[model samples]
Target: MENESVLIRYIKTKKGLLTVSGILATISTVVQFIPFYCIYKIIELLMLGNYSAEGLIHWSLVSMGSVLVGVVLLYASSMCSHVAAFDILYDIRMDLLQHLSKVSMGYFSQKSSGQLMKIIDQCVEKMESFIAHQIPDIVSALIFPLIYVGLMLMIDWRLGLVSLVPLFLAVAIYALLMGKTMKNNKVKQYHDALEAMNSNGVEYVRAMPAVKIFGLSVGNFKRFHQSIKDYRSLVMEWSNGFRSGYVLFTTLITSVVLFVMPFGAFLISQNPQDKTLSLTVMLFIILASGTTGPFMKLMYAASTFSNVNEGVKRVDEIFAEAPVKEQDNVTAFSGNRISFEEVSFSYIPGSPVLKKVSFELKPNTMNALVGPSGGGKSTIAQLLLRFYEPTEGTIKIGATDIRETTIDTLMQNVSFVFQDVTLFNDSIEENIRMGNRIASIEDIRRVAKMARCDEFIQELPNGYQTKIGEQGVFLSKGEAQRVSIARALLKNSPILVLDEATAYADAENEVYIQQAIGELVKGKTVLIIAHRLWTIQHVDQILVCDKGEIQATGTHEELLAGNPLYQKLWAINEETKEWEVK
Candidate 1:
């Protein structure tokens, strides 16, 4: 089966350990048959009217010893599997995380965090369970039957062949049933349903604030409710479909004596002289019937193979994505000027978001991009960050094409502070230190002061060490933005990109944020995207963009005097500022 192949390939790294486990499991399973053989011998002695207490006690001790040895071997086998399984899990998770770090940010836009979490957490755990527990079960399951059937045939070939007939029939029926289920693609459907539910559940929880504020009902949370309903329906359908086949399989496999007893009795009827031998063979057949229980357990464990295979395939899909290529011979840049030369890009093919956008920022100069909401201003910033490669043209930092250098090299020279500032649930000092890992206490404090965050940070109970969550303290948007600004200032990169950095600042914090920006951008090649027209009025240059094209590019006074679009925007900005509350 495809599932079997997936598991085999995945465990190739741990094949040595798994092989040892398998060998041990097979030995344990073979040892288990010793008690059955001892019982048969004792029964034979009784039938022959040679009852001896010492003989009985000896055989009983032998049987108990075999059982004890088998238990030890089985425990050793499980121990090996457990060690290998945990090691393999660690390797798998580490490899996945490393690959994700190298993958382009564009990959994240198409995949949800919930979906990735399910794959990384749940799917990997499934693989671990399969490797640790199910693998030993499968090994014993497979070897037990062969050894058991061989012993039966060695005793009496007729009853052995008869006993195997029901097993073969049960297997055929099982195959047919599984074939139908596979054809229905139930496994894939189940995986999809679970992923959807995970995604929707995460989304619903994240939207709880809005839900409560609007008094949203279950109907309002349609996507989450629908996913739950759909998952329930699929589970019910799968269980209902398997119900009949499962009953039939269990009955046929477990009832081996039903076939063997009849054939066995018929054989004994023909030979009265060898009555003791015939009766002993029948007892052996009855004892061997116990194997069906282990077989059923094996089948139950094996059924999960499909889910494991599906999980492996999903994990492999993530690993298969091409990472951002780094040039082997590339070196760092020496200048600070940034330029976009006729660059074009599209999130989706055929429909361009940035149409041959061209721009330049001189070193140590302020440049502003003024545009409508969807006018590609953010796309330009994203491209500069190399989150996604441009479909056409080139972007250069200083004299080097950005694609020619490694992402690490490019990122080391530039810093960005966007509108949506995300602060981790950690201490204030730690969050600021993320900008520059090697920054000392004094260095962090210097930037914090520059960003106007030191005053507020000092006011908190733990000062710089205060955690940023419900347990410690919470920050307003403006305060959070200042912290982010502190981070950017600490990095002290030559090139700076500010995407609506002051958008969330209150009127009071705006003055401090402006002063922070003044300190941060003093000697950097700055490219700022702003909606507040008044803020950029004194900038060195402003580019007015509309419909993914630059309509005009000049100083603010030049634009207001000659560009009609700019004039109208400026007028509206002025009007909004002067409007009084009723």
Candidate 2:
């Protein structure tokens, strides 16, 4: 009941439809039993020598009519349940996505795409089966046996008690099966194996290009190979663990007649002249056999319930994650002067990425952060965008603390171009329009020309309408970077953060990208995580960071002469300038 509480909220939305389905299923169960009762009436009439053509026809027609009505009601019940199931599935998926959008990027960093995909796609889908088929089926399955068994008891106490014996044994064996499964943690193991397999399979597909180029075999990919092996082992173990109990339950359920028939025959043999006793025994035999099917169906529903319960629990876990909180009264910034005062952070608890670091970028100034690869330069940029919150201290824009402002306001003011450019599998125009949704086609083209990607875009088969990763219209790394810049330019935010915008560009592309950035930072507060020191030499301020701390702040020449660490980095950079491929 506790596990089902989480799912109940989602179910409540379509409770009316579910209720109708259940009611219809109940009626169908009662109507289905009428056929068996009508058969008994016809047999009694014949044995008592009270048969007539009209009576025989009436009973036979009643039996067939009952079956038809039952079928119609069952069909209507199924239709209602199916409609509710699909609508609920849609609502669950939409809610999941909405909740995910509120959580921090750090949550995504800790989870894989495959793991999330399994929860979003497969786990939520399991609820559809339970709602559509199992819900209605369970209603009928539970009611059918109760209705007939009660009727049997009203007719004769001895046969009714005897009929229940096999059912009780079947229920006991099923309970034992469930207990063994839970005790062994079968449900958890089953989901874990599936998540592992899905994760590995997605990785294998993504790495297929590299695999083919390197002539790699399945055996060489240990993670994927081991996932398959683990799944096989788990399936074998799960099947074997329940095999005996399942067989016993099935055998007991289907052989209900075997138990009741012998006792019924003994009663009839003891009272041979009593025609009523003989007819009662025959009726018990007919009804007891019918009860087995409902019990079988119930066992199936119970098994599906366990799996779906596990799946819904996994979905609930995603919803349980805390989202980034927002202030009730947000403070608007007065200016774009970005400041970080003693802002410390760590991706992991004890290993710090940025430690008591502080910096400032004055309004409309181009500032540069130059450091070694893992020296917290990029972390500083991410912190400004609130991809993560600092462990201590404050980041402010003018007189306003960043935490006091809404995320939408902060995002609208800042435009970021990542070191690794991301372009969707969409048209060139649509991809650039992501920055400013209301930007005109001319606006997009103007920025594209400024970023120097206009010529290649025009040369494509469909021009700006060409789709990426389709029709052989893929952009090179440098071309993609230019498109990314065009997007940021279109945004035209008051503050800009560039994390190595030209890191992967060729010399020609670098020249064009620099021209684009020259236009983008005209009236904005800019922060650049620079790799090539020469590019940012003339910026207003340069901060050299080392080992998660800002070691020095100065102009290019001042740092080169006064800081030993800066001098060493400069020497290394200069040496790399002369290196050439053999």
Candidate 3:
């Protein structure tokens, strides 16, 4: 595979099919010249004053038969190429998807959903056009001209040389149309504009609610509006630049006979009695027009190369990314105790979010991370779940480094519930089952009841079968949080991480969710990241975090009794509790 072209490597599985297609296309192109040759023979016979019904009929039938055979071969060639093209597209997309799954979560943070979608959908699809249509067209176009020009030269070298004048001019015009500037600057700009438009359009849709609440109009949404403007301007600029050059190329290619006719006429007059020479000039007149078809196809194929090449390079960029490294010799853990030994992390280099942070969760004990906003509580939970690796130092479960075990092995032991819940547009039962794929319907019901979502779920029109998201019933914030708990409960992992699980809950829902959480954490080591100090008052240990460092650790009573940051947080929490809307 080394030094192989991206396109050829992808299509190698169907190389034999493409080879067969190319052979058929070449034969079809050669057969297309039969009608021209037949017309020439008929004209030659007439000029020599040789008249016979059999001779005319024989050449006419051969011309018609060659055309029919050519049509059949061309059809076969197209079929083979199209089949190979679609299969290769499927393989490429699957490979991309599998690779994406193995990459770090950080990769997704940097890429927009729209950008990835364009690469997977539009960029990959671009290859289909090149492989299916252009490959065969290019092969036939290249062959047709060489054969046509060669036969003309054999008939009359003078007329053959004249026929090439328009072809040369047409090729020159085409070259200017597909110059380096058009390829590197214009085409790249067009794709960039398109990607920007797509990304902004997605952002605009996702923020539709905020826009409506703020009374914002499309014109006021500057990002989306500017994207549309730039896209329109680039398209106009591209089309205008291409329009004249394409017109000139087309005129030169199609009016090839005009280049041959005068020269042909002058040669005919040079020896009017030379019937062979006269017939040859007439032959060039009739066939020169037909030659335009292949040359025109060649121009079109060459023009498309820039766009397809650009898209292919974009696709290649995705394949060039490195996925998350996995352990070769996976180490087995001996217990449920989780420890972070002076672990430090940062999403970007040189800006530490967790500086020399260390903590231990004794097996089966409950712990809470209570901190102010931007104090790295959520980051600690994410680090434990291996959503990201520590920049320095080790995170171990029972004495084994988390990195020494496979991701699957690490994830199986730890369950995390995020502040933001993501539920698919699927049945409530299906959504919960994502936590445990092989869980039976009865097991799902048991966990749903434990998470306190079973009551509301049963009240829905279709109960557990009811779908969620846009096309179905939308759950309230608290109801969705309960459903997320139901998933964690089903997983029943040894350790759990709750990241502000009750942050969005109402008082009544919070009571029910707490009762559900009481059931979910039984016999499991737990870590709760909470902003509400009152919610974590009864935890076994409270770790006070501030400015990327663990400042203090104590029970609720001890922290409020001594630590200033803890006392201040508690005072603020108490004040907010007594506030009223009036």
Q: Pick the candidate with the highest lDDT.
A: 2
lDDT of 2 by residue, 1-582 (tens): 445555788899899999999999999999988888888888899888989989989999999999999999999999999999999999999989998987887898888788899988988888998999999999999998788778878999888988888888899989989988888889889999999888888888889998999999877889989999999999998999889988999998988889888998899889988989988987887787687777888998999999998888888888888877778776778999999999899999999988899888899999999888899999898888888888888999887888898888888899999999999989999999999999999999999998888998999998999999856587888899999999999999999999999989899989988998998888999999997888998999999988999999988989988998888888888888999999
lDDT of each residue in 1-582, candidate 1, tens digit only: 334443465588899999999999989988988888788778877888888999988899999999999999999999999988998888889888999988888899888888899999999999999999889999898888877778778867777787888888887888887788789998889989999889888999989999999999666889989999999999999999999988999899888878877776777778867966576555757565786877886776767787787888898888788999889876788699888899999899988998988888888899999977899989889889988899999999888999998888888898999899999999999999989999999999999999999999999999999999868899999999999999999999999999999898889999989999999999899999999999998989999988888889999989989999899889889999988889
Q: What is the lDDT of candidate 2?
A: 0.89
lDDT (0 to 1) per candidate: 0.88, 0.89, 0.88
Better of 1 and 2 by TM-score: 2
Give candidate 2 regions above 4 Å deviation: 1-5, 42-57, 271-275, 440-442, 458-474, 506-512
Residue-pair clashes per candidate: 0, 0, 0
Q: What is the TM-score of each candidate against the true structure?
A: 0.90, 0.90, 0.90
RMSD of each: 3.2, 3.0, 2.9
lDDT of 1: 0.88
